[model samples]
Target: MSCPRTKPAWSSLLGNSRLTTIPIICFGHLSIMVQVGDEIPSISLCEENPSDYVDLKKELAEGNGLIIGVPAAFSPTCSDTHIPDYISSPSLSSAGKVFVVSVNDAFVMRAWGKSLDKEKKSGIRFLGDATGAFTKALSVDFDATSALGNVRSKRYAIKTVNGKVSGVFIEPDNTGLDVSAAQKILA
Candidate 1:
């Protein structure tokens, strides 16, 4: 019996070759992970509340800044070590407009920020990527369902100069506490 389905363009190009692998070009949304020299995505993130949104692209457009991506808010490693390290770092003041981004709601991010920097001495802003839009825009969102119950960003640190990435530090294991640490980035 002859198959009724028409062959795809790629299959027609291959012409019945017994190739084990075929390359296909898809005209769909392609996500490219953040890298050095890449411009910050024009995605809005929430601050203290859901209604208050901040455009990161605009915020970092004219300054030296640091964007820190943590898997979740209030998590053990993130709360205890990661963020605190940046808060206490002497280099922090020079880092300029430091932002801590988490795949959480604005209320949760605000509370977590308060819990960590009680006096707000760190001057580090906590941003909420509620729908993971910002994280996905940077192509850093990971399937953290087994751990945090949903998609979360990989542990990463990006140094930006005028909204363009100058440095990218991402933990290879997705949620480790090493390469993206404040001490290393600040130094």
Candidate 2:
């Protein structure tokens, strides 16, 4: 026969008024965004066409890389300028493996990637954070329900070295292209 159920140690500790109260740290309420020196999270991002998944943490650990976070794929600024900058920039060849991450699905990201790099000449990899898990792990995902009817990643770029962020540029309003631009980051 199974013994009677008992409250866990945590519950007993919580009930002990005599024990000093310790404040718990809550990341859910944190408003801070990802910053330099933060380690990249081991989240999987997807790619379409042939269909594959990449673990960002593993990528980071393998070598230096750049992660560009955008609000959405095919949006005016993202389509017209942001991604194109990296595609056309000479520095891109030397910027290490580059990833363009968005909250869209794999199909949309694949199409957008093809549109941006029809010849696949550029090495930029378009990644779909379909569930926003990777984006949230970076602390760069934001609620864009009003504008996009879903949560999305803020505009940002992170330069990573062996899984650790060496540099970061995050757009203040999540809509601007000033800070996270390739020119600015390369400069």
The alpha-carbon RMSD values of the candidates against the true structure, listed in the order shown, are 7.1, 9.8
TM-scores, one per candidate: 0.84, 0.82
The digit string of per-residue lDDT tens for model 1 on 1-187 reads: 1223444556756755865244444464567789899999998899999999999999999889999999999999999999999999999988889999999999999999999998899899999999999999898988889878999999999999998999999998998999999889999
Tell me, by lDDT, which candidate is best.
Answer: 1
Score each candidate by Cα lDDT: 0.91, 0.86
Task: Give the alpha carbon lDDT tens digit for every residue of 47-153 in model 2.
Answer: 88425888878887857799999999999999999999989898886678899999998999999999999988998889999899888877788889999989999
Q: What is the Cα-based TM-score of model 2?
A: 0.82
Residue-level error in angstroms, candidate 1, position 15: 30
Per-residue error at 88 for model 2, in Å?
0.4
Instruction: Rate residue 3 of model 1 by lDDT.
Output: 29
